[model samples]
Target: MHASSRHGTVAAAAPARGGRGGRDRRPKRADAPDWAKPPARGKQRDFKNEQRAAGGAEKTRQDTPRATTSRSERGVRASEVLRAVAPRTSAKAFEDVSRGTTVLFDDPREVTLEEQLHYEREGHVCIRRAVEGVEMIPMVKAVTGEIIARRLEAYRHRVSVLCPDARTTELKDVEECKRALKKHSQEDVGFLQTFNLHRNESSPAREYIMSKQFAKIAAELMGCERARIYQSCVFVKEPGMAETNWHSDLNMVPLDTNDFVTLWIPLRSLDEDDAALHFANRSHRDFALPYWRTIEGMSDLEGRYEIDTYDELDLGDLTAHHGWALHWSPPQPKDSVPRYALSVCYFADGARRLETEELRRTPHAEDEWSYETWLRDLQPGAVAKHFELPIVWP
Candidate 1:
């Protein structure tokens, strides 16, 4: 079920206190949830350890075929890629001649489904007018306001409320929501906490929303065998927040196919005045260079801001060029009011590993360092493990 209907309640299985074994205990870290942590206890290991472990495990399994069971052999299981190819050109370079030439181009609504689907197939991304109506807007607006207040409080005043730093308020606010809910551990709080990861043992929200009705619809709409709630996130656009730079979903998990999607449900009525999130419309069709690069420079380096450089990458032009190029969340003017939205990501079943190795190697010193050498030594089987819960919302 959509988390909105189940908001403010917890499940019966929730631990009564903090800790893994309690009636409603969910994991917590400073301003972050324990669920987001690396899968292993030792957080200092590097990527080399992971590579070596992954490699070694593969080798051992190959050599002693009888030792491991079928499930054990299916490491990092997601649907296999239907095809592979040489890296293609960056879709960002294409110019849109239609921008001024066509009468229909002036009206975004006049754009046909064929145009959108064509872009989606080529670019691997697209967005549309998926929802509307005035009543829905007000409800989302109220929920959004509460979300913003909760987010602002959680940062303990760390948010900068301006460019560069401002771009990240959405992420910060999410961390805050997690912290607040984790701190209270009440049934109602737990329900709100499920905005991202809809798994709370004591979630009263889950009890009400866990019917098969929604799941069946979700699976049909999403075109998957099962629809599971993985993680939830909220997006808030206050004045001066940087337009979210261009990026892709796969870099976070490094998946193999287009087997995942994010359901973005706005909590307020969206209009021209509000900063509407623009998209490439079909960005997923191409191999998305880790969008993280634009923010962090490279996958291995700590991300630094390049506002002018990031802003200059014309998104509309790029979309027309390769179809795979797209971006969303334009910036709000310094004098304008902010917008609020809630979003969540869902992957095909068994798409993620614990990423303990990556976490282990990441330095906590808050400075630039390299994790490459460590990455080379990683063994296949040495990666930390993650387990899927028996989803029983119904």
Candidate 2:
């Protein structure tokens, strides 16, 4: 077994009994604690009386009225028991017990305050069945096909023979674009990233992005008065794609606040072996950390944080992480199916653009799109409220 250590490294755990080393031999009673000792193999232990005894005197009193008591009588009995116990028990203990047993069976999708606190502290939270009953497989296939078609069209102009409807316009530029695409295609193109799908108002992806269910959760997780969808993209990672290097989204974007968040929704079920996303716990608080410029830079900061990841996640399960949270994914397995995921980035309302020379100088694709084009007109310290970044929540 592998366990994550405090410093984000994988720790080896002792193998289970009867595992590869044949370590199932029973321990001597002298060395084992009374609670740890198992009963004789062929003998049966009588646990009925013990169970009844362990339930205490209160259990007997509670059971006496179950069959004959009216609903009001049962409530009175419960009240009486509470009164009797109230004097002896600490208020905190009683409160804890009450909280432990208080269940609202009707609202199954509720997120408790404790969970919100965890998200605040860890900078990320995974919510199971966040968007149920939505068939993601078909959506994934459609988006994948669209991206491929778009890429082919962009590259076709470069190859004269490949262009079906060749016109006399801009042949030189077309050839240049095709050559660039051909070179990229020859390499291990890790994933097909189709960004700004929401810009196309008629796209199905746009409708999904604007759904109230998704926007509400994003707003809640962000603890923002409102949230706006700044960017949306579909990532299709084919088999044998290279691992995504560790990095923080905030460093790559021009946003001034750490209130920015990203929602990662996988199109299918994924296990740990499927290159599921991994995060460095509470690393979002490390604001002094410089922008990750190289793989070596990421490695240097590994020891400062503990890594967190899900062992398995079903479809409809999604994860939301702070923009500054350090995260990465392993390389796609050679034999596994392509991994398709939709990523939507949300920024808190009133977020401003940062004036960082480093961000301006960075040659990353995200910087170019998010800063150069999206926030081109807005000066540093200006509000990030461009038409391209629309508010999705209130």
Candidate 3:
């Protein structure tokens, strides 16, 4: 229930309620008083009030807006993309992601040496149309059903002074939620985030997050023989959500490894105004203990680094960045759709826990949570090989 930009409806506006159609079909002339006349040109009409004065109540469609998306339709959509959890027709596609040891590169998604080198030097790279149409359908359905459908009650757990709407009464849909939201807040008002979704029981996300194509790319980019997924997170920014502060993935992770990379997959296409993820080129080289931390405060550093972004990402397109690469997203434009994305963090299969002292050296807000969630089972010097952090590649 994090702040999430989502799909449509809720306003009494015509478009949302199927304008005109939601009203009585009887002739309007009959409802109008014989003495009443249309408002003069260049002015407006208060038809409802006039009707009331005329002793005619405008009849509206009785069904509430929430029922617009019929239960039958919702049922159909949920089942449609689930016929095959993994889109691949190959028998090899059926393994559980957690222990799926072999990365099947034979499916033709391997990265070229040149592409791998680009990542090595720039700390980030975009793979155009890395996923296909069928591949994205399930990804979207899984996220929308899990996040957006939960609505506003879940997003306001942390109130933001900037987003008064975050405290509004529970809303019916994405559009209504967006309208209620006042503005973006650096505190992440409109952005809904959930981590380890792949691990959720009866999850609809494992197929995409654990896709071997993604793992093979991670392995190639990290120059490792195998890769393990540390976590899979879904981030959705509702329209009107604010800019994210500059930060690095590794800065919040408790693992000790420079071999990490995160694959950011957009469920739909994106434009810059859609809250595109931006990165500081070559910034991974500057990352270490407290590298960007202890600064006066979080601020944009385009002047200090060569900031770059894809500006647009088609539905199948996704980007991967080094764990330590600095990145951020802009405030999403109000009228735009929610920006939905899935991010899977991977590392060499043998990644170990950060030294106890080093872990203590940095007071990352997530350290305690991370330890409680994934690292409590292993000692500091031990290779991270718990049930949750599975080896996703051979």
Best by lDDT: 3
Total clashing pairs for each candidate: 65, 0, 3
For candidate 2, the clash count comes to 0
lDDT by residue for model 2 (234-322), tens: 77666666556556677656667778888898766664456567776777886555434423234334345556665455666678888
Model 1 C-alpha lDDT per residue in residues 1-394, reported as the tens digit of each score: 1111011221221111100111122122122223222223232223235547687764453243221011111233321211111222321232312111121122222224553454335332222332222223333444454455555442322222111124333544556544543453221110111133233444322321232332332333344664444344455666555445344433333322345454444443333333444433233543343332222222211111111111111111111212123333445544544545544444444343323333211121111111221222323323211222223211
In lDDT terms, how accurate is model 1?
0.31
Candidate 2: which stretches are off by over 4 Å?
Answer: 1-110, 133-145, 151-188, 288-297, 356-363
* Better candidate number, 2 or 3, judged by lDDT: 3
- On the 0 to 100 scale, the lDDT of residue 198 in model 1 is 31
The CA lDDT of each predicted structure is 0.31, 0.54, 0.57
For candidate 3, the per-residue lDDT at 320 reads: 90
Instruction: For candidate 3, report its TM-score.
Output: 0.65
- Please list the residue runs of candidate 3 whose C-alpha ends up more than 4 Å from where it truly belongs after superposition: 1-98, 101-106, 149-190, 287-293, 296-300, 360-371
Question: Once superposed on the true structure, which residue ranges of model 1 sit more than 4 Å away at CA?
Answer: 1-142, 145-149, 153-222, 254-257, 288-326, 352-394
